[model samples]
Each structure stands twice: as structure tokens, then as C-alpha cells.
Target chain A: MTLNLEPLWLTLKLASLTTFVLLVIGTPIAWWLSQTRSRMKQVVATLVALPLVLPPTVLGFYLLLLLGPAGPIGKLTEALGLGTLPFTFPGLVVGSVIYSLPFLVQPAHNAFEAIGSRPLEVAATLRASPLDRFFSVALPLALPGLLSGGILAFAHTVGEFGVILMIGGNIPGETKVLSIAIYDHVESLEWTQAHWLAGGMVLFAFLVVLSMNLLGQRMRQIGQD
Target chain B: MIELDVAFRLDRGNFTLDVAFTAPGLGITGLFGRSGCGKTSILRCVAGLERAAGHCRLDGETWQDDAKGIFLKTHRRPIGYVFQEASLFAHLSVRDNLKYGMRRVPASEHQIAFDEVVDLLGIRQHLERAPSGLSGGERQRVSIARALLTSPRLLLMDEPLSALDHASKQDILPYLERLHDTLRIPVLYVSHAPDEVARLADRIVLMRDGQVQAIGSATEILSRLDLPLAQDTEASALIEGRVQSHDDNYDLTRVAIPGGTLTVGRLDQATESRIRLRIHARDVSIAIRKPETSSILNVLPARIVEMQEIDRSHLLVKLCTAGEPHPPLLARITRYSRDRLKLEPGQEVFAQVKAVALMD
Candidate 1:
């Protein structure tokens, strides 16, 4: 049988969209977590890291409730003419973003913290305003961490299965991502198709991990020089 | 004048810093103190890096005044600070690091040209290299050049050379001296090294236990017997003099101090050009009468001003030239010599200096 290939394409699309959205929103949150001296820092950090420890189904279940027709957010969206989000492509994007948030935030926060206060102070004495220093000094110094965070977030989103099943129910082009499609094939005893998809996933995971290690080494070498 | 009246307490440790002093706005004013004496904290306050409550006025501009509710942030203050470490941006090339501040400053406020500072700091050759590849001295020189390119009105240096090795410090000191001799900006240099202060500062603000002990001209402050400097083993006296003559035959230069001439090692300076001399107290010997012939070249008649017992074995003798107005000199002599020579506050004697260091 000819492979449909629709699930693979949809998986890539969802991971890409999720990674992009997470980076845009995660950066400031990570920066705040790194620099803040407030008592609320730990609470905020724990919330961001909840997906790493809690089962993906738990997060997906809560998200489904929040985005379903009877939920507060769903009702508000309906009133604004956007309708409810559950079982839609946008709903899948939202679930993936939350599932992979800690993957993006932890590295970026660590990178920012490793910079210490000296460079910023030096920049200030040199007449660089706070915004200027943040862009010129802090951003460049933290680029390696951000890049790694983005890659991890993308890979983790690609591998996610339970969250999408719960909030983005298996709708053909909208929500039938690679992992769910593999499960469907196996349940129907379509062993050849299942083998092809599972083998592709293993290769993809290996490549992602290998690239991350190589990139990390390259960054470390540049830092040393 | 640069007026600083600041008081603050640190939370990490039970340290309270309270100091007030006014220094001339034209030269390097050394903040001399021991480690943990809050010298760096005072510099931070002046730079607006620390949130200390007080008034800091540079010339006529008020940078901070708690009572008036006016506090300029560090970036708003026209100041350059060189930290103990070079603190160059690791990601930027040396050239970019030097340009970082210059680009932020408005064109009209750019009094210090980029090339001028690079040349002044002798970092023209390493501009394209990354900070991580540079030696400690090179990094510090780049940092100094970066600060200068901002065209700051006041420069704050917090133990800038303390992190360097001895050889690196030696390599960087001449550049500092050049900066002092050429630059017009007022500088506040904080350092625990007495030699660095003696070499660079025109005025000295001595600090002890987070308090301002004294503020005076370097010559007056370094020689004061009442201060802790005179009691240390490295105690020395600073004397300002003019070049009188060069003895080409012996490769020696005769400098005319307040009361007498001192024949020191040959100097490159022209006749009548001013110079500074550093005579260590340990290198000075007292004689009841002037020797007719001796290897020591500097022997001038002086009267004992006061004496303090540094220990049971040693005495720090404060003396002034017998006939003319001169900065007092300190001599650390054995108590046995003081007894043998019957040295007293008003007694006349000769001070034989074994070694005299010529400082510019």
C-alpha cells in the first residue's frame, strides 16, 4: 500500500508552528525568571516546568476543558466570533506549545543566568542604556541557549502523542499527527506502514539529538576562542 | 570640585559605609584603603552603580542627591568605570567592544575620538581579536579604551589592576601614567595597593573601616606619621622637586628638592622639569653628623619632628628639612640607632637616603 504521507506533513507543520509561537512568548518569561529577585519567581518557574513532570494527558485534559464550548475561554472566544478551539488545528498548536514550554525556557534561563551582572554593569558605565545593553550584550551572549531551546521544543513537539489525542482528537488533516497515525496503523494490523513510520521517527529523533550535540560543541568551541 | 557625601549599609554583611570628601576636579584622586574598607563601594556610589543614599556632585553637576530626590542612573551619568576585572563583552570583538559605548553617545558629546583612545591604550594591534583570546593586560587596556571612547566627564577605576599578574600590572602602568599625563578628565582611582596610589595620584583620600581618615595632597598624606601608611613596612615619603643638572660623567641627575639637592639615577627629563621622588622609610638612615665621604648620594640636614614606636625594635621617625619648607620625610630606623643618636623632636641630624625612586 502507498503511504498517505499526510500525517508526516501535518506533524512537521504543527511542530514548526508550536516552536515559533513558544519562542516568541517564552523568551521574556525566561528572562524574567532569570533576573527577578521577587518571591514569586519560584512559583512562576514551577508552573512553567509542570509539563516536564506531570503526565501529558493531565495537561491535555485541562486544556481541552479550557478550550471546549462550555469552558470560560471557549465561551469568550465564541462571543468574539472565533468559536471554540477543541478538535481544531489551532487547538493542536496550543497543546503542543504548552507541552514543550519547559524545553524552550530552561536553556534560555540558564544562559541568561550564566552571564552574571558584570557585563551589564560594564555596559551601563559605557553609557549604554538598559534597552541598548539588553539587545547588544545580553541577547548575543544568550543566543546559544535560545537556539538549543528552540530545537528541543521543536523535537519534543514532534514526539508528543497523548496531548494531541486528548485536545486535538484524530481529525484527518487537522490532528492526525505522525504518532497518532502510527497507533492507528498498528491497531488495524497494518504492520508494514507502521514499521515505515516508526523507523522514520527513530531516525528523526537520532538526527535531532546528534545535531544538538554537534551544535553545543561548536558553540563551546567558539566561546573558548 | 568632586563632592561625595554617601552613607549606606550592605545586607550580605554587617558593613556600613559612611564617607564624605571633596577633591579637585582636574587630577587623579586616589581612594587609598585596605581591602574590605568599602573603597569599591564608594566608587560604585559615584558611578551611580550602587543605590546609596547621599549627595554626589561632580564639578557643579549633581549626580545623586537623596534629599532632593534626584538620582541619575549609571547610564545617564557621564562617567566611565573600569572594573577590577576587564569585563569586556565576550561575544564582541575588541573593536566592537571599544565602539559599543561610542556609538551610544551623541555625536556632539564625542570629545574623545575612537582612534585616539585606541592609540592611547596601545590596543590598535588587537582590535580584531576576541576578548577570550586576549591576555589579561590586553583585555584591561581594551576595556579602558572602550570607556574613554564614551567621552566621560569623570572616570572611576575600581582596583583596575588588582586582577593582573605582576608582569601584566607592570605592562599596564605606563599606559595609566600616560592617561594621567594627557587626559583632562577627573579620575577617581580606588586601590588597596599603596604603590599604585603613590605612583598615580596627585591627591589621596585615605580610608579606614568605611570612614574617610584624611584627604590631602599625595605628598602630605603619604608622609603623615599619624596614619597607618607610615607604620607599615613599605612606608615611604613623596617629595616634589625640579631637575637641576645631569652629571653625564656619572650618569646621574641632581634634583633640587625643598632644602637640598639629591643626586639620583639618570632621568630622561629636561632641566627644570618637575619630578616626583619616592624615598622609602626603610632606605633612610640617620647620622648625628654629615659624613665627608660616602656611597649614599642623598644626605640633607633635617630636624626630627616626631617619633612613633612602630614596634619594640623599630621606630618611625618624622623629619623636616632644617632650612626650607619641604614635605616631611619618614625614616624607619632601629630603636638602637635612635638611642645611640639621642634623637628627639628638635634635634638636628642628617638623613642619608640609600635609594631614591624617580616617579613622574
Candidate 2:
């Protein structure tokens, strides 16, 4: 089967960028979820998990509105003189982060929960301030959970299609990911290109998931036990 | 003097913990109660771990006062807390865990040194190992050492030995004894075992149903006939004794207690080491007259200071020996024995203490 490497590279780039961005933003949110007792915890938890249950196309549809030239997010970004984001690589990265929120949050929250408040309390008794405790105690204990969460989010984004299809659209070297490439090849009666792209994604997904599962298992074993 | 006058009402799903108490300023003041009795919660309240409803003040330093708007957070409060579980950071080595507290506590405020705590706990050997590899007793010792290194004004421990087995408890107990005897900082020890209280507590605050039942010296409260703990066959009088002499040939040791000289089974040790001795209540036997021939070596003439029924079967006799003003110790005998001897609270008799067991 004839192979097309451009779309495969784009998929890797998009998924990698998305996972990195989510980690930076998701860490504090996940920490808050584990530590907070406020009523807003439930509200925020439900909001973060919405992407897990809501149809990917539905999520993408609203995201399209929010990121379109005339929409709130798009208008604000344009005011800062950045060009339109719809159907661009950056657009897919944003969509990927939103769509994979739970993939990152649930693992991060679970890790934080497993660490418990006892260690943190001990840290405080040791004369550590809240910030110091979080950095010195919580972060090291939560490292495994964070790594697993990041891996899961990255793998999930690699396979993402419907969300990227609606919001990212098919722009070669921009938003034309592996799944889109395979779809486009089949539609143009190019069976060879379709099979090549599908094979690449399968192999990539297998390796990524295999390593993630191994890491997740290793992390779970290392935590608290 | 450290004064703790605090109140808190928390309703978990099935349990309720609301406590208030004040302890003596010096020595180890034990907060003792059975399981699920809010002992840990009270310690937490003192550490600022849980915010209670009332006021908490120590040595005139205010920790929390809802009415006056003074509520210091747990970190802000100068307290050292050791929990039931070691809860040491698993990622850090034993040395790092010890240092975790030292670096955060400014050099100006904390008087304790890293080397002092390491030596006190005898944790220098395990300094490089992660917390997970250490035994239960080892982890607890590290937990205690970590808290002490913080240099807090007061130390609070919540059933630190509960998770440990008998051997482990024994291993950690000496370290605790040293910490209590040598350190100037007072400790609030939460425990339910009367044995532990008798051994360690100078003052005991007995808790039942979330309230302080009685607050007094261990010797006084432990001798009571009604408290749940006072009913044990192991019921003993905790007497502070100084080693007077030891006769290796006679196989006997002499101890000078507050009231009089006590001759007990010989121990392989020299004089000058202070020992805590437990003379079990059931071990005592009173005679109207001084008996001539007996295996017992202790028979001091004691007057019946008080007598009370312990149960349907037994009578508790409080005896005052003929030396100065030491507090009286109790002896449990049958009502028949009490009636047959025509015993009264002030009746003078030779109080024959059966035997004395030396405790650390």
C-alpha cells in the first residue's frame, strides 16, 4: 500500500501539543478537585467530564461556534491580531485538549486521592507551608498519576476523529490528521493510501497504548504501597 | 503552662467528635480513651488540623478563639503532631523526610537541630532508605523524629502505637520515654491502655463519649474502683521508686519509694537508676497482725485509708503506709475478707503488698 507521511506527522504534532497544553492547565484543576470540599467541586467535576460523555461531534459543533471568526473566542483572538484559528493546527490542538479533559483529569484526580491528605498534614506539621507541602510532598507522590494522565490524554487525542473533523476540518499539513487522511483517500477511490494510513495509525496507537499501560501499571504499583 | 480550652462539633456519617479539655503545663499529660472515642480529633483540634468551636490557648499564646477572631491555621500554629500512621513521604528517603521539617522551620524559630533528632530517634542507620522499606516500628520512630525536628512548643501524638504489634510498641516505647524525660517540651499523648498511661502519664485526662471524664494524676485515677480500666487483674499502683541497693547474693533489690523502703525481687542492675514499679492491687494481702513466717518480703503497717465495693464479689481497700504523705494505693479483696477483719477506712494494719514488678 502506498503511504502518505504528511498527515501522520500532523497527527503526532497535534496530539503532542494538545497533551502538553492540557497538562499545564489540568494539573492545578485536578489538584483542586482532590483537595476541595466546596459545592463547586461537583459542578466543576461534571463540567470537566462532559467531553467524555457528550458526543464528540456535538462538542465540536459548539467549539466551532466559540472558535469561528465571529464567535467570542475567535473575536477576542482576532482583536489580539492573531489570525483565524478554525481549520488550523492550533484549532485542532485546542479541540483535542477539550475532548480529552477526562483522560487527563480522572487519572490526575485518582493519583492525588491515592496520595491522601495525611502526608500533606504531616508535611504541615513539619513546618511546611501549603505551597511548600504541595511541591515537596504532593507533587512527587502524584507524579505517577500525572504521567499516566498525560499518556492517556495523548493516546486518546491521537485517535480523535469526529471532533477534529468538525472543528479542525481537512487542511493538509494543518488539520489533515491520519484519520482524516484515511477518510479522504477512501473517498477519492484511493484504496492504497487508505490502507497505508490506517496501518500507520494502528501501529502508532498500539505502541503508544502499550507503553502507556505499562507506565500506568508501574505508577500504580509505586504509589502508596 | 499550656492551657487548651477548645470545643468542636463535627457530624460525620455515623460518628460524632466534640471534645474540650485542659492539661498540666509540664511532663507527659495523657489523653486516654477507648477506640472511636474522639481521641485523635482532640489531638487534631490542638494541632489546628481541625477547627473546633471553642477557644485554644497554650502558654498564653492563642491558637484559636471563635469569639475573639483569632484562628491560626495548622501550619501557623506551633505544634508537633505524630499520627497513627507514619504517613512519611514515600518518595523521599528517611534523611529527606527528617529534613522536610527542618528546612521549612526557620533557623531563628526552631531550636532543635537535625543531628539531635537523628540521634534521639536512632534513625541514623536508616537515613538512606525510603520509608516503604522500613518496619512499622522504624517508620513510627521516623514519624516521631520528623515531628520533633520541627521544634514546636507542644507535641501531640494520636495513638501512635495503635498500628504496631506488641514487639513494635515495645521498640518505640523507650524512645518515647526518653523524649518525655529529657525534652523540656510537654507532650499530649492520646491512648486507651491503662498500662501505657500508668507508665508514661504524669497527668491523665480520661475520655468517654467525647468528654473529659476525669483529669488527675495517673496514680489517683488508676486506683479508682469504678472506671472501666480499674477493674482489671492488672490493676496496679504506679509508684516512682529510686533504686537504693541490690544484693546479688540475696537475690533482692531495695527501692526507696515516696512512703517507705520496698524490697522486691532482685533485678540484674546497679543502684541510682529510677524505675517505675507496678504493685498489682490483687497482689496485696492485709493481715490484722504482723505475720512471722512467709515468702513475701514486703509487709508495712498501713491504715485503711478508704474502703469501697468494686463489684458484687470484691471490696477495694485503700492503704496509707507509715511514711510521710505519699498517696494511698488500692488493694482488691473479697467482701468476706473485709468483714472478717472488721476493716474500716482508718483501721491500722500491716499492708502486705504481695510483690512489686519493676517497669521502666
lDDT score at residue A115, model 2, on the 0-100 scale:
83
Question: Compared with the true structure, what per-residue lDDT tens digits does model 2 show for residues B177-281?
Answer: 888877888789999787788778888888887777887888788876667557766677777778999877888899988767889888755798887787888
TM-score (all chains, Cα) for each model: 0.97, 0.94
For candidate 2, what is the DockQ? 0.80
- Consecutive 10-residue window with the lowest summed lDDT within model 2 chain B: B1-10
lDDT at position B230, candidate 2: 70
Candidate 1 per-residue C-alpha lDDT over A143-188 given as tens digits, one digit per residue, 9 for 90 to 100 = 9999999999999999999999999888999999999999999999
Q: List residue ranges in candidate 2 displaced over 4 A.
A: B1-20, B266-275
Lowest-sum lDDT 10-residue window in model 1 chain B: B3-12
Clashes of each: 0, 2
